[model samples]
Structure formats: structure tokens, C-alpha cells
Target: MLRSSIYHRPKNNFAYAYDEETLHIRLQAQKGDLQDVTLIHGDPYIWENGEWIYSTSSMKLVGSDDLFDYWQAIIRPPHARLRYGFICNDGKESLTYTERGFFEDVPTHCHYYFAFPFLNKIDVFSPPSWVKDTVWYQIFPERFGNGNPKLNPTNTLSWGETPTQSSFFGGDFEGVINHLDHLIELGINGIYFTPIFKAMTNHKYDTIDYFEIDPHFGDKETFKRLVDECHKRDIKIMLDAVFNHSGYYFEPFQDVIKYGESSKYKDWFHIAKFPLNPGNQLSYRTFSFEPTMPKLNTENKDVQNYLLEVAEYWIREFDIDGWRLDVANEVDHHFWRLFRNRVKAIKPDAYILGEIWHDAMPWLQGDQFDAVMNYRFTNAAIDFFAKKQTTVEQFQNELVHVLQSYPQHVNEVAFNLLGSHDTARILTVCEEDTNRLKLLYLFQLSFTGTPCIYYGDEIGMTGGDDPLCRKCMEWDENKQDLELFHFVQKLISLRQQSPAFSKGEFSFHAINESLVSYRKTLGDEELLIIINPTNRSLKVKFPTSFADSIDLWTNKHVSNDLMLNENEFVIMRKMK
Candidate 1:
């Protein structure tokens, strides 16, 4: 046996309480080194006649990455406490593993095993339940619509003009209010807007003021009306909070620049040296070397109080539903923890989504963000569906790794997206192949987590990265691809109506280089999703036995054999 391959830690993702009653435990071994693993667990205090009573549960091979195979099992400890160890086996030999060390046989003493002292309900990661059901629409506010052409900036180009980083098309709160019916028709239940606070640029990531809406977007009353209108339609609104840094022109940063070391706000930012220099050369900390965005010193108490007030003021004043924090990874955890307390106190169900592009396990422990901008999901989808850089098996493995990186509840509410303001549009990334784009959307809408659609994505808008991706919303019915829009609408409707699509257990049934098949099962309702990413027609076998099935997409009945056309996908529901 490859005993050295066995690995386990008693905390974090490996072993953590999923809820007050349920405990999730995991073990990792070198890829393909172990045939199976069994978790032997029980309460540490439960001893009768000098013997510790225990229960054994088989651990399934949940996921495997390039180097490791992950084994997982969910257990319920009667008293909310657990002592556990693993029994690993290869085809040829078996070994016992425990907290103290590896053993030849099961240890008789309970002290030798790992222990979870108690499961605290307070520590369990709990995001708002509404998030799982939400279909998010991400809007770059300045480009969404021009409801008030009067508010257009001096250099504003006509609507539908290609966007530049500094272009202003006068998309305001009134524009969003006028288009509530459009989002309603699109089946979007949640709207995530980029930074809308007063700022110099059209994109508005750099904030000049946190409390007031930008003049380009609208005034306070206009925003309140927009929030009211959205709530009437049952659409939740999430505004962006850019607390990681402030714009160069922000009052505090400007004061620092003007007064140098004598400024009372000198400690508000990270200054490498006094007499601030705003250029390519090093001086103060900035966001990605951009001198215009000076990083905030969140550790400062005054800074924390100011930002926290900004956090609570919006929720209390506008009745906003959530906050999507920008550059959240850069902010101090202490500030976020306090931020969570302040926000949740006013609205317990308010969703806090962080803009974290990478692994966010550290911030997702029920203390900070409810979810993050799932850029990992975007990268994987692009690699598999757009770039064809990975095989079906490899894509499935990577996806499984992502899912297993967090608890099941966290995975359910993860903010999954295909394109965003920061990246190339999905259509552009797919080389303008609408078929590939459709396949990508099909997978995204049906997969786990809360799926987000970048504005203009469903309408077949295509552009390159950054400023290009932030183009104006195409409102002309004649120019929009209504077919693609309806297709996406159907996907959203299916996600809403079917429990199997939203809350089902996922497993790959069959996988290959060109085609992949997966199943989402929840009790009696089972759905099979099959995709063909290649250009040639292929005959793919159904991995599960089915007598009669209806294609959820087209309502076509199927029996025995299935043939998929080039770039086609299908979701089938088994009929009893």
C-alpha cells in the first residue's frame, strides 16, 4: 500500500460542520492509490464498559485532481460531537489511519482518533436561502440603457456606440426603472450592478463618494424609485461596494496628496513615503499599480468606521437587497467581519457577495461573503466549451474540484458567471460561434450554483475584453437576437420550475473527448444533460436505463437510442 499518500486535516474544507446536525469529513490520497476509504466515527464520550462505541460509513470518491483523489462522507453525530478516523484499502492491503499516526489495526483507545469537540451552529456557513433560487443579471450601469438622454455627459456619444474606458452614455436609475419589465421578461430575479457611487469614470469602480449616487447614474430619489420598482417586480437589487481603494480624486486621498505628512488623513492610505507621487514610479500602494486607485488602509479604525457606515447607510436608506464587494480579497478580514455584522444586523437575509476571482475558502466561512464572483467557473467553462483546451474528463475533474473546495451549501449559492465587465464577452471568446455560446449557456443555466448573465450576453452582443466588453445595451428589437434571448429564457424557466435542475445531486454518467453526459437527480425527478461540443454529428449512448423520456428543451419523446447533431445539447426527463 502507498501509505505515504494518505492525508487528512481535521479542519477547513477537509472536515467541517455543514450544519448543526451534519458533519462533513474528507480524506485525500495520491491519485488512484487507494481503492476505497471508510470513516469510523462516533461521539468521543460515548463509552460503555470501557469500550468506545463507533459507527462506520463508506466514503465515496467524490473528486480527483491532477495529484489527489478526494474521499468524502457526510455524517450526523447524535450529540453534535465527533471522533473519527479512516480505514484505507488498496486491492492488496489495508491500513488504519488516525490522528496520532498510522496504525496496523484500529486503535482501541479513543484518544488516538481525531476529534471535533462540538458542532457549533454559529460556525456553520449559512448564506441566504434566496440566493440559490436567484438568476442574477450583471449590468454595467453606464451601458445598460439611456432612459434620460438629458443626463448624458458633454462628450457622450450616441447610444449603441462602442464603449471606451472613459465614455459616458448616460445610463441612469431611470433607465433601469424603465427596463424593469425587460429584466422581468428575461426571468432575472436578481440584478448585480457595477459600482454606481459618485466617481470620475463611467465604469465607476473608483469611488469619489460612497453615500451618493453618481450624477451620470441618478440622484438619491431616482435610485430609491428604482429599488422600489424592482421590489414590486420581486427583483432583488445588489449594488457594488468598492472599499478596497479610493479614487485619486477622493477627498481623503486628495487631502493626503495636498497636505503630505501633516494631513490628519495621512494614515487613511498606505504611503510608502510622504509627499505622495501619483505616477508609474513607486510611492503609495495602489490597485494593480494604478496610481489613480490608492489602496485604503482598512486596518485603521477611522477607515473601518467610515466604510462600515457606508455599508449600513445604503441598506438602511435605500432598502437594497445586497452588496457585491469589489476587490474584496484585498480588504482586511477584520473589516469584512465587522462589515458582515453591520450589514446583517439591519437585514439578516441580505446577500454579501465578494469579488474574489480565485479560491475564496478563507472568506466564505460564514463570517464574510455569502458567495463570490465565480471566475473559476468562467475559466473552466471557457476552457471546455469555448477554447476546447480540455477534454470532457479533465473538465469534469476540475469542476468537481471546484465543487468540493467548499461545503455543499456554499456550492449551491456560488455566483456562477460566464462573462463579466472584466473579461471578453462569451460570444467573442467563442470566436463568434453562436452554437458554442448556446452550449455554454445551456451548461451554465443547468449547473449548480446561482448563474449570472452578463448584460447583452443573451442578446448575442460580441466584444473583446475590458472596454469592448462594456458596450452599450442593444435595445433595438430589430437588432437584438431574440432567438438567443428566448433560448436563454427557456433555460432560466427550466431552472426555476424543476427541482432536479436547481437542487439535485450531480454526477457524470458518461464522458469522452467530444461528448459528455451528466445526471442531476433529486428523489424521483431525474434529469440527464448531454452535450456535443464538436462539429460532426455523433451517436452517444445513454449511461442509465430509461424506457420513456421527454426532452425538456423540445418535449420530444425518446426511446433507447439518441443521436446528437453538431453543437447540440439536450436535457431529458425520465417518464415513469
Candidate 2:
């Protein structure tokens, strides 16, 4: 037994409140160390004759990474509080584990056990129930479509023209309305639009007006119609919120520039100097040294009220379903809490997604954002699947870290994406290999969390980062990759029709250097996905014998020995 490798805690992902009544506890041990482990737990106050009376529940070996095996137990304490310990057996001997570390004998006192004092309902990490099953399609509105050329900005270029940072091709809400069938046909249930608020740039990250829709994108009435159209089709809309900074033309920032230190709105932004210098990044804190965007002082009461009111106005008036906060990590935590409360008061099921690129445990504790754009998931998948820069073992470990970083609820709604407006298209990243693109989509759609497909990604569009990636949507069917589109459509269709896709417990295995296999199990329903990332044929042995199983891809019965061709994959599900 590797005593030093045993690990557990009564907080975060290890032991967390699945709900007001249930607590999910997990323990970690060195891989292949313990044969059996059991949870010994009881209410902290449940003591008889100076001895703590407890119940024992066997823990399931959920998963194993390169170095550790994860064990989990779901318990419902009678009084919503628990003092727990673990008993491990390696076949030769047994040992008792507690808060005080290893002990030869089980401790009788409650203090010797780990404690979950109370399972508070408010602290439970609850995101929108709809988000877990949602298949999000991220739309960069400026480039998606153009249904209303009359609303185009002056000197707008023709559609499909080469894109520059400031270029516009007149993509309007009417255009999106016209293309609703495209998304529907592709099976998208959620839309995440980059900022549509009135802004200077086509991308709209630099907000000029929070309340008004960009005329280039259409009027507020058109946007409301768009919202109504989406809801009618059972699709949800999530708009971007750029509260971290304001554009150079933003009213408050303009006022600060005009009046310098004497402006009443001076407190709204972080203005370092009396004479405003818009060209220098040092004049005031901006969004990553861009002088055009001045950082907002979210700590100000007026600023908080203004932003929160803007947040409330959209939900109350437009009935927008969600807010995808831009540069969310730079914003203050208190403001987000206020924003969450205000948004939830209007719509309790509203998803608050943040654009945070790193570990975001602090912001996802049920008090602030529901989940961040899962860039960690993005980078790992790219490194392993797209770039081929990481070994299979390393890829599995990286993903395990991501899954273990958050509670189960957080992972469920995590905005997992392969590419977005901010990054290069996945096809381009794979060097235009349609085979590799297929592999990427297969992994993403089948993995845990709500997966997002960037606009044009499903149709095999390829471009580099930023301006190049933000090209106009190919309206011509002949130019689009219909086969790839159909493949993606099939994946989304499978996800919607199966509970295991979104609700199952996910586990990834390092099958070999060239093949990846993962399983999703929900009760007796289980799906095992195997992929071959190389150009050569590969075979994966069945992880276990299934009583009755069928290959979901070919819709045929499968055998234990299966050969997968280059860039080929299979989703095998157990049959009743």
C-alpha cells in the first residue's frame, strides 16, 4: 500500500454538495494500490455512549490517470452534516484513514474524522439545467450573414471579401433570422454571439453603448424578433458582455476625456492622468495595452449599478437567455456576484458564462459565473488531437486535471469549444485534414460538458487566427463541405437522443500512443468511444465483455476484436 499517495478532502471537487441533501465525496490513491475502499461516515452529532456511530459504504473506483486512481461515494446524511473516514484494503491488510492521517485502529471520536459541517443549499454549484444538454454554436455576427444590406455601415465591403480588423460585410440580425434553418438543420440548440451591443469594431468587444443594438446588426426590434425566433425553435441565446472596459467612444469614457479630473464620471474609469492620452497604454489601464479601450473601475458603486442595470435591462426586455462575459477574469468578483443575483432574480435558469482562460475555481462556486469558456479543455484537445504534440498518456493526464479541477455540476455546463472568434479555425489548425477534423468533432461532441461549435466550423471552413478566421460564411452550398456537415449533424443528433452523452460519468483511457478510448456510463446504459488518430489501422481490445452491444457508428453488432482505420472512430453502446 502506498500510504503517502492516498488523498482526500471535504471540499471542492473531492467532497462537494451535489445538492442540498446529497454530498459527493472522492478519494485518491496510487494507481492499482488498493483493491477495495469504503467510506465510514455519520452525522457529527450522532454519538452514543461517547462513541461515534457510523455507516460504511463501499466506494467505486471511478477512474485512473497516469499516477492515481479516483474513488467516489455519494452519501445523504440524515442531518445534512457528516464526519467521514475511509477504510482501505489491498488484500493483504486493511487500514483506516481519517483527518488525522493513517491509524492502525479506527478512531471512536468524531473529531478524528473529516467533517462537512453543513450542506448549505445556497453554496451548491448549480448552473442552468438547460446548459448541460445544450449544443452551442458561437457566431461572430459581423461575418455570419447579411440579410439587410440597407442597414450596412458606410463603405461596407461585399460579402466573402478578405477580412481586416475593421472590415464589415453587413451581417445583420435579419441575416441570422434567414439562416435560422441552417443552425436548425445542423442541430444547434444554443447561440453564443460576440457582443452585439453598439460598438466601434466589427467584433464589438469595445462597447460604445450597452443598451442599444448595433445598427449594422439591425435595430432592437429585429434583435427581439431574432430572440423570439430562437425561443420558438427551442434555441437559447447568449450575448457577450464586455464590462471589463469601455470603448473610446463610450459615453462615460468620452465624458472623462472631456472634463479630465473634474468630470463626475471620472470615477467610472481608471484615469491616471489629468490630460487624457488616448494613444498611450500607460495613460490609464486598458484592455491589454489597447488605448482605445479604457478599463472600467468595477469597484465603483455607480459603475456596478450601471453595469448591473444594463444586465437586467436585456433579460427583462429582450428576454436574452444568457451572458458570456468578455475578459471576465479582469473584472472584480463582487460585481459578478451582484450580476449573478440580478440575472437569476429575473431568470433563475440563465447561464452566466465567463471568458476566463485559466483555472477559475474562485468564480465558479455558485456565487458568480456558472462556467468559463473551457480554454483548458480546448488547449489540451488541440495539443493531443489536432497538433499531435502530446503523447496519449500526457493528454489523458491533462484532461483528468481539467475534470478534477471543478465539481461535477461545473463540468456539465462548461463551455467546451474547439475554436472561437478569438482563435484559429479547427480545420486550419489540422492543416485542412478533413479526417483529423472528423476526429476532433467526434471527441468533443462525445465528451462531457456542453460543447460549442464555432460558426462555419461544421461546414469545413478553414482560416488562421482573428481577422482571417472571421471570414464571411460560405452561403454557396457547393463550396461547403457537406459530408463533414452531415457527420457533425449526425453527432449532434446522437447526443440529443442519448442520455449518456451529457449526463453520463466520463472516463478516458490511454489505450496506446495512437488510439484513444473513453467510456460514458449512466446506470446500465454505457457508451465506449474508441478513436485512431493516425493514418494507419489500429485495433483496440474491448475494455470488458458486454452481454449485448452494438457499434453506434455503423448500427451493427460488434465483436471484441475491432479494427479501426486511419482517423476512424466508433461509439459502441450496450444494447438491452
Candidate 3:
């Protein structure tokens, strides 16, 4: 046995309370190093005359990447408090693994094993239950729709006009209200809007005031009506919170500039010198050197209290469903913990999403944000499906690493998005190929985590990154790709109707270099999804026993031998 390759941890994703009664333990080993693994667990306080009492539960191989094979064991600690270790096998020899080191057999003393002191239900990392079933739509307010032309800013372009970093088209809450039916018909249940607070920029990431809605969007009453309308339709609304920094025009930042060293709010920002000087040298820390966006000092107690109140006031007053914290990774974890407490106190189910673009395990421990904008998914999908820069095998390996990075509950509610305001539209990434975009959508909407569609992406809207990607909504059906829209709409409908698609265990199977196959299974319900992204037609084989499974797209039984054309796919689900 390769003792050096065996590893286990007692907290976070490695070993966590899946629920109040159940504990999910995981182990990592060099790929193909271990033949079988078992969890040797027992209550810490329970012991016999000599040996400590224990039970062994076999661990199932859950997933693998290029370097490691992951194993999982699910067991219920009778007392919710336990000590555990792993027994690793190499087909030739068996060895017991413990906190100290490897031994010939399971340790007799409880102190030698990894300890999960107690499973407090409060520490179980429970996010909102509704998130698992939601399909999110991300809207950049300035580009979505223009229902009120009267609210247009000076030099505001017409609806459907091209977008620039400085351009505004007057998309408001009333416009969102006018177009709610479009989302309803598409089966979207959650809307993740970009920052809408009062700000000078059209994107609104720089917040001049956290308490007020941008006048261009609408007054507080109009937004209230929008939220209530969405709730009536069973849709959840999540607005962006840009507490990471304050805009140049923000009151506190302005006060600091006016008073300099004697400013009462001087400590609110990270100003390096007394006299504010931007022409010679940038003295204050700003958001990426933009003098307008000054990063907030979240460590300051006054700042924390002010931000926490802003987090709660919206939920308490308008009954908003969620807050998507912008640049959340830069903000201190302590402030987020306080933010979570205050928000949850007002509304227990309010989804707190963070704008984290990478590994966010630290913030997802259930005391901070509920989920993040899943940019890992964006990068992986782009490299494989959109750019064709990676082989199918490499794509599968990247996905495995991402899935194993967090616990199953976190994965269930993790925000999954293919494209957002920060990236090129999904269709453009596919080189304007509707077929390739379809393949991307099929995988995203069917995979675990709540999927989000960037506003104009459902149709065939195509643009590059940043300013180019933030184009106006296509409301004219004559100019839209209605065919692609229907295809996406159908996928959303199928996802909402099938439990296997919305919330299910996900796994990928390696085929040849071009074909992709994955399974989504829940209880006895299972869905086998196959996609062929290459140009040549190919025939894919499914399990022989699944010959009579219903094809989710056509609602007809398909044969074991399935042939898929270029960029073709199928979703086959077994009858429950």
C-alpha cells in the first residue's frame, strides 16, 4: 500500500455533516492506487473493556481527476459525535490509516482517529432549499429593456442600440415588469440582476448610495412592485450588493476628499497619504486603479455596521429574495459572517450569492455567502465546447476537479453560469453557431447547481467580452433567433419537470475524443445525457438495460444504439 498517497480530513468537504443525522466522509488517493476503502468510525466516548468500539462502512469510489481518485462514505453517527479513520486496500495488502499515521490494523484508542467533536445542526451548512430547483436569468439593467423612455438619461441611446462602457439605454424596473412574461414563458424562476444601486456608471458596480435605487432604474416603489410581481409568479429576485467599494461620488469618500487628514470618515477608505493626490501618484487604493471606485475598509467597525444594515434593510422593506455581493472575495470573511447573520435574521431563505470567480470554499462554509457566481463552470465550458481548445477527456478531468472541490450540498446550490456581463456571450463564444450553443445549454441546464442564463444569450445574441457583451435585449421576434429560443425554452421546461435534471447526482463517462456522456441520477430516477460536439456523425452506446428509457426531449423510447449527428445530444430518463 502507498501510505503516502492516502489522506483524509475531518472537516469541510472531506468529512462533513450532510444533514443532522448523516455524515459524508471523503478520502483522496493517488489515482488507481487503492482497490477499496472503508471508514472505521465509532462514538468517541463509547468503548469496551480494552478496544474502542467501532464500525466499518465501505467507501465508494466517487470521482477522479488527472492525479487523484476520490472516495466517499455516507454514514450516520448514532450519537452525532464520532471518531473516524480509513482502511485502505491495494488488492494485495490492507493498512489502517489514522490521524497519526498508517498502522497494521484499526487503532484501539479513540485519540488515534480523526475527531468530529459534534454535529451541531446549526453547523450543518444548510443553504436555502429553494435554490436547488431554481433556473436563474442574469440581467444587466441598462441593456435588458426600455419600458420607460421618459427615464432615459441624457444622450441615452434607443432600445436595442449597441452598448458601450459609457452608453445607457434606460432599462428600468418597469421594463423588467413589462418583460416578466418572457422569463415566465422560458420557465425561469430566479433572476440575478447586476448592481442597481445609485451609481454614476451605466453598469452600476460603483455605488454612490447603497440605500437608494438608481433613479434611472426607478423609485423604491417601482422596484417594490417588481419584486412583488416576481414573487406572485413564484420567481426569486437577487440584486447585486457592491459593498466592496464606494463610488467617487459616495458621500463618505467625498467627505474624506474634502477634509483630508481630519476627515471623520478618513478610516472608511484605504487612503495612504493625508493630501489626496491623483495627478502625481495614486494615494488611495481603488478598484483596479480607477480613481472613481475606492475600495471600502470592511475591517472598520463603522463600515461593517453600515454594510450590514444595508444588507438587511432591503430584505426587511421590500422582501427581496437575495443579494449578490460584488467582489465578495476581496471583502473580509468576518464582515460576510455578520452580513449573513443580519440578512438571514430578516429573511431566513434570502440567497446570498458572492461574485467570486474562483475556488470559494472558505466563503461557502454556511456562515458567509450561500453561493457564488460560478465562473469555474464558465471557464471549463468555454475551453471545451466554445473554444474547442481542450479534448473531451481533458474537459471531463477539469469537471471532476471542480465537482470534488466542495461538498454535495454546496454543489447543489452553487450558482452555475456559462456567460455573464463579464464575459463574451455564450453564442459568440461558439462562433455564432447555434448547434454548439445548444450543446452548452444542454449540459449547463441539466447539470447540478442552479443554472443562470445571461440576459440576451437565450436567443442568438452575439457579442464579445465586457462592453460588447452588454447589448440591449432583443424584443422584436422578427429579428430574434426564435428557433434557438424555443430550444432553450424546451430545455428549461424539461429541467423544471424532471427531478433527475434539476437536482441529481452528476457524473461523466469518458468515451472517445469528441463524444461526451454524463449521468444525472436521483434515487431510482436516472438521466443519461450524450453529446457529440465534433463534425462527423457518431453512434453512442448506452447501457443495455436502459433500452426502454424515455427520451426526455421527444418522450419516446430509444434503442440502446443511439446515433448523434454533429453537435447533437439526447437526454434519456428512466421511468420513476
Per-residue lDDT of model 3, residues 206-288, tens digit only: 89999999999999999999999999999999988988898999999999989899999999999999787765478998877
Return the top candidate by lDDT: 2
Candidate 3 positional error at 390, Å: 0.9
Better of 1 and 2 by lDDT: 2
lDDT (10s digit) by residue, model 2, range 341-376: 999999999999999999999898888999999999
The stretch of ten residues in a row with the least summed lDDT in candidate 3 is 509-518
What lDDT does model 1 reach? 0.88
If scored against the real structure, what TM-score would every candidate get? 0.97, 0.96, 0.98
Error of 1 at 94 (Å): 1.4
> How many angstroms is residue 48 displaced in model 3 relative to the true structure, after the best TM-score fit?
2.1
RMSD list, candidates in order: 1.5, 1.7, 1.3
lDDT of 1 at 454: 95
Relative to the true structure, how large is the alpha-carbon lDDT of every model?
Answer: 0.88, 0.89, 0.89
Residues 309-352 of candidate 1 have per-residue lDDT tens digits of 99999999999999999999999898999999999999999999
Show pairs that collide, candidate 1: none
Which numbered prediction scores highest in TM-score against the true structure? 3
